[model samples]
Target: MAGDASPAVAALSEAELLSRIFPRLAVDATHSAATLLGPGDDAAIISAPDARTVISIDTQVQDQDFRLAWPNGYRSTGFDVGWKAAAQNLSDINAMGARATSMVVSLTLPPDTPVTWVEDLADGLTAGIRGLGADGCSVAGGDLGRGREISVTVAVLGTLDGGPPVLRSGAQPGDVLALAGTAGQAAAGLALLESGVPMEQLDDGLRNLTERQRRPVPPLQAGPAARKAGATAMLDVSDGLLRDGRRMALASHVAMDLDPDRLGPLAAGVEPAARLLGRNAMEWVLSGGEDHGLLATFPPDIQLPPGFTAIGSIQALGIDEGPRVTIAGRAADTGGWDHFAD
Candidate 1:
């Protein structure tokens, strides 16, 4: 309790921690093999005889990565943290064109953390996992230790399900760039909250804006669908689209032009949130992060996969530089989220 910032962070008990945090970290049981051994005894084992296993992990630490006191209650913050961890990890499996079969989480926190906050964290992770229909992934196992701040790490195991994995380098110049899900809502929400605007003052239109900061619902189905539809290249919109799109452009060696008109429709009804904070909704849509949407490029004339809209087009290589982002034929200056740079 030496450096604990909140009273809630200092009141967590062992049983309380077990109930709240443990469930969220358990892996799914239904899809696992009968030969898999876990809990109760010495060590855990699994039989993956049929399909290829793909694994990915992600970790989060307080202050350096998240704030327990920002925007909302500690419970909401825990939920957001858990949801983000699950989304990022699950996206890695989806990127491989695989089905996530299981997940395990390890958490470290200050001993004084409240039991309720831990439970909320687990609930958030569960909500996110359910959204993906990742039935097999459960909170399988983890270890906890005393720490100065909360730290969470999740490892996800997936089955390729007999398909080829999509990669960032697969895009070509003739492909059409498409996206599913809104961009920048989280950033706008952060702005609103930061500017001292109360959530009650805003209408329902902006709820999604704030929610984006808490729980990012990734388009899990889109990756496999695009692969099935013969997408030439693909990526998840974890970072801002412009930044990630620039990544795609550089990786594939092409220029990208985005139609703001097309993007405008994708971000409909968020102006009130913008107005509340004296910010531009369009700027949020263009530059926000953590939406966890899907971004992909496909053949120009082919029918697009379901649930996606045409947002832009892949361009031929330019003589000027790497990954130019243009809006309505004019160059856009913003392209990324630089954590350390202003």
Candidate 2:
């Protein structure tokens, strides 16, 4: 119903559809190194040089995680969905301080979905893998099925490169908390879209913000870099800063004190959009999610790797404070993206 109704998936058999899409995916340079055996086989073979694999999976469903038509929705392209599907799982691997080496995607579509859309989605998947400078990673294989709505599930495989996986529970008191990539911009973009502002009238900055919300590009390299730099604890910021920070704090049995002053620079990028909407930029910075930036902690003496900014410090949990996160010396709310939150 969304695209041109002609040349739909129903026009061809499953084998016919695979013939059209598989070649586009198999030709990507990124897949060649990781995939020993690709499509047309019973299963794909991927290399795991580190003797251990870090795996993560994520799913995106139509109208829930995305929408084809809505002022507040992404009105997403196939590439956008493909890129985002890969990105979310890649970020998870990165959070563990590993390099993503391969992925398997599962897609479900309505009978009337366009074949071109599926091909474009494959292109987006390859683009996302190579986009992270992960030239060796590939889409191993996937399953396709008819469903009520379009849905994508991506599972990624990563390698630690002989390094220990960084766990959220390893942070210690005096560890310097750092962040890589962005915060708030994606949320601001969502707000702008919901505001019903005409996309054509938006400035370049606002356009970029909305694009981020639709398809976030997390710093995939930063994860392994943080691990190599001796990060004690880490995670990707899929949820809001406050929410994810609290998760790490609780896991580590510590408390975090985030300085508002230090977060100002990070919040600056969203200020224009925030002002235009008459909203507080800082709130977005604090509570906005889906940026997929890496949040990590390191020994106070360790120099942070490139792309990371020191934002806070870890502390011993006070008896009353419990395992919590604080901003500007006050306990912060753990409000963020909750799938079933009322």
Best by TM-score: 2
Model 1 ranges with Cα > 4 A deviation:
1-35, 39-51, 71-77, 318-321
lDDT of 1 by residue, 98-126 (tens): 66766777788776676556776888788
Off by over 4 Å in 2: 2-6, 27-31, 72-74
Per-prediction TM-score, please? 0.86, 0.96
Residue 117 of model 2: what lDDT?
85
Q: After superposition, how far is residue 279 of candidate 2 from its true place, in Å?
A: 2.0
Which lDDT tens digits does candidate 2 get at residues 62-118?
988877765843357888888888788888998999988888888999999988889
Model 1 residue 211 lDDT score: 70
What are the candidates' C-alpha RMSDs? 3.4, 1.5
